[model samples]
Target: MPLVTTTEMFKKAYDGGYAVGAFNVNNMEIVQGITEAAGELNAPVILQVSKGARAYANHTYLVKMVEAAVIENPNIPIALHLDHGDSFEVCKSCIDGGFTSVMIDASSKPFEENIALTKKVVEYAHDHGVVVEAELGTLAGVEDEVVVEAGQESYTHPEEVEEFVSRTGCDSLAIAIGTSHGAYKFTPAQCTRNEDGVLVPPPLRFDVLEECIKRLPGFPIVLHGSSSVPQEFVKLVNTYGGAMPDAIGIPEEQLREAAKLAVCKINIDSDIRLAITASIRKHFAEHPDHFDPRQYLKPARQAVKDMVAHKIVNVLGCDGKA
Candidate 1:
């Protein structure tokens, strides 16, 4: 199938009580890993490109890679998306550059400014047959160029969603309900130690999500910064000369619950990065004599496939949902 918008995918997810996985892609291995897993599972998937990704890999290259994935996996639905387009110009570029979906992240601006910016992008995107996803609240953490300090994070106010959606005319909305970007989603002070002294982050604010659902019935909701940050990968990184400490992420159980609700799309990036990094680090440690990129990246790509497969079956519950 050709690249499609998130419209039908979200509708099916909202009705079936499962969320489609939106995985960030920066290079060929990551794209292959994600789409291959989705294709094998018969699941719908979204390949997201952030502004940083566009800077890293040229937009033309990224789009061509996604097109290649589409040709290779013809059985499942796939959408090429811009993850966090910070401005109307950025959104417009993606819309004109063959992106099936784009996100106009104006949550950092004031309410009126956000609506105006999103509305402009929506008008342009809709005319071009691309769908728009707008964000309402700010999430704290670092993902590429997006950065928010710990105390600066704010949860989505359910009271504002109706007005925002009505005026902006965005196809879907991403709400910040305690989920954050990057591996260190929560600080050590914000979490409690478990029986084994592992840090357990605070829970997501479901009450706020439920209220938003009440106001926008049947609308597709999105959760960004939704990576689970598997500890085994963290352990492997640390074991192989990496020094990341106190890195934690949203629990898969909580994300599973969110998927069964109004949440129709879950963005996962850090987990894939962690899986690839850990695998590469381990490979290099074991075979220090090997210098070929393919030698190490082969296992790294497989690690991504394995991690994505787990999320499809366990966290997203969209396996066989194509």
Candidate 2:
């Protein structure tokens, strides 16, 4: 009923071959949307908060909102998580502030430094009945509070995973295997449709993933910037007079395949944002006189709920696994 750690969720996902969706929450609407979807699907969910989000919504408000979701969804497991924590202080703060899990993402630092930082957080978190996730290879996405230039995008080195895990003792490891952050993951030049005119993003580097699995064995792996940008959401946004500039994400099939492997947590955020924006845009276009916040926000919340439900059914593969 209360917030739990990701340890059990990752273990079950590893054994069940379904990755739990870690959807970032910025406000009450997003939290309500993500938890309601997961609850309806009978799936365990992770409500993650990023540093930018904490600053935007305030940390106390986000924590209280997730607590409220727990009270509302007593049948399903809900984990409050800190996403992409960059410092010891950040991770420690979250661990102390009632987050069930916290990610100490020091992958951009030197290898030794990353291990040291992760170990520190893990040691502290374990003492407090919390779980810790650490990133090995830096992802090339522009998620809130985590911005890396495209030039910096690089796949996780398989050779280092074993050592990183052995030393850090993190409960889960987030890896980068060609899935970058943000909606504009690829350009039109990088993709072309088949005979059926279905979209096909560039293939994920499964070879690298294979190598990581070979090194870590059954260790839980995570995928960040994992939002599968729904074409329907994009259509809604564009039709309502918003330009997204050909945003794309990793295909759902690839994510499904990864779920069957070591992946237990798939981070998603951009899709939720896109869904809210689309609904709000349409409401404004249709109701020019609408001024009350709830007039448009209510529809936006419903749209997010629908989007998350679709994701639980179509992506992440967490349905019926609560």
Candidate 3:
């Protein structure tokens, strides 16, 4: 099938009690790895690109790579999305450029301003047959160009959701409920150490999520910064000439629970980076004489495929859901 909007996907997920994985794509390997797994598993997937990604790989290159995936995997549904678009121009650019969906992240702005900005993008996107996703509350942590301090992070006010969605006409709502961006979601100070010496981050404010669900009944909810940084990958990276300390992410069980709720889209990007980094690190360590990019990237791509497949079957529960 051709690239599709998240409308039908979200409707199905909301009723089926599952969320579709929206994996961020940067280069050819990452795009191939994600879509290859989705194709094998017969799952519908979203290939999202950030502004940073567009700058790094060039917009045409990224879109063509996604187009190649679509052609190769004709059986599974794929949606091209713009992740965390901060302005109306970027959302409009993606809509015109070929994305099936775009997110207008005006959450950092004042409430009225956010609604106004989101509504502006929604108008353009809907007219062009593209779907819009908008964020309500601010999320803490850094991802690409988005950086918010912990003190500044605010959970989505359930009371405002109805008004925001009604006025903005957003197709999906991304709410902040303790999940943050990047590899280090929580600092050690905010978490307690478990018996295994791992830092246990504070639990998600499910109460807030539940309240939002109650207010926006049947509307698709979204979760950003939802990657569960697997400890195994972290250790692998650190063991082989890397020095990332105390990196943590949301737990898998928690994300699984969220998927079974009203959440229809879960954004995961850091995990793919970690997986690729770990595999390349291991490959370099084992083959000091091999300098070709493909020598290492081949294994790195395989690692990504494995990780995505695991998520499809276990966390997102969208396997065979195409």
Candidate 4:
């Protein structure tokens, strides 16, 4: 099947109380891993490209890869999206370059400026038969080119959501409700020790989410930085000569609960990166002579496939939901 807009996917997710996974793709293996898993599970998926991804992989290459995924996974629904688009120009480029969805992230701007910028992108995107996603609040942590330092992040003001969506006419909204952008989402100080002495991050601000749902009613909501960094991968990376200490992420149970609400789209990036990194590190540690990219990348791709499959069945609850 051809690429689809998120309109139908979000509608079904909203009514079904599940969210589609939006996995960021930068290259062939990542695209193959995510789409292959989504196809196997019959889950609708979004393959999103970030600004850094476009710079690294080139827009044409990324689009062609997603198109190949569409061919390979014809049974499931898929969408090409631009994640965290910083301006109207980027959004317009994606829309024109075959993306069925684009996000205009102007949450860092003042309220009025955000609305104005988002609205402009929304208008152009709609005209091109594409959907627009907009952000309301700043999320902390680093993801490619997007960054917000600790203490600078802000939660979405529930009061402003109604106005922002109404004026911008964005198809979906990404809200910051304690979920952050990277693997090290929280510092050691922000978490408490569990029985295993693992630093457990704080709970998501579902109260804020509930208020936004009450105001927006049936509108589709999105959660960015929603990856639940699997500790096993973190341990594997650290075990194989990596030095990522105390890297934490949103709890899967919390993300599951959010998916059961109005949140119809959940963004996951860091988890994919960690999975690949851990696999490659472990492979090299075990086999010191393998130098070919495929020798390592094959296992790294399987790691992504396994991680995405786990997310489809466990966290997303969208298995057989194509």
Please report, in order, the local distance difference test score of every candidate based on alpha carbons: 0.97, 0.89, 0.95, 0.96
Candidate 1: tens digits of C-alpha lDDT, residues 122-209: 9999999999999999999999989999999899999999999999999999999999999999999999999999999999999999
Q: What is the lDDT ranking, best to worst?
A: 1, 4, 3, 2
Candidate 4 deviant stretches above 4 angstroms: none
Tally clashes: model 1. 0
Candidate 3 overall lDDT versus native: 0.95
- Residue clash pairs of candidate 3: none
Top candidate on lDDT is: 1
TM per candidate comes to 0.99, 0.96, 0.99, 0.99
**Tens digit per residue, CA lDDT, model 4, 1-322:** 9999999999999999899999999999999999999999999999999999999999999999999999999999999999999988888889999999999999999999999999999999999999999999999999998989999999999999999999999999999999999899999999999899989999999999999999999999999999899999999999999999999999999999999999999999999999999999999999999999999999999999999999998998999999
Instruction: Give lDDT tens digits, candidate 3, residues 1-322.
Output: 8899999999999999889999999999999999999999999999999999999999999999999999999998899999999888888889999999999999999999999999999999999999999999999999999999877899999999999999999999999999999999999999999898989999999999999999999999999999999999999999999998999999988999999999999999999999999999999999999999999999999999999999999999999899
lDDT of 2 by residue, 177-212 (tens): 989889987777778878987557889989988898
Listed per candidate, the RMSD to the true structure in angstroms reads: 0.5, 1.5, 0.6, 0.6
Checking candidate 2 for backbone clashes, the offending pairs are: 141-181
How far in Å is the alpha carbon of 76 misplaced in model 3?
0.8
Model with the higher TM-score, candidate 1 or 2:
1
Question: In model 3, which regions exceed 4 Å deviation?
Answer: none
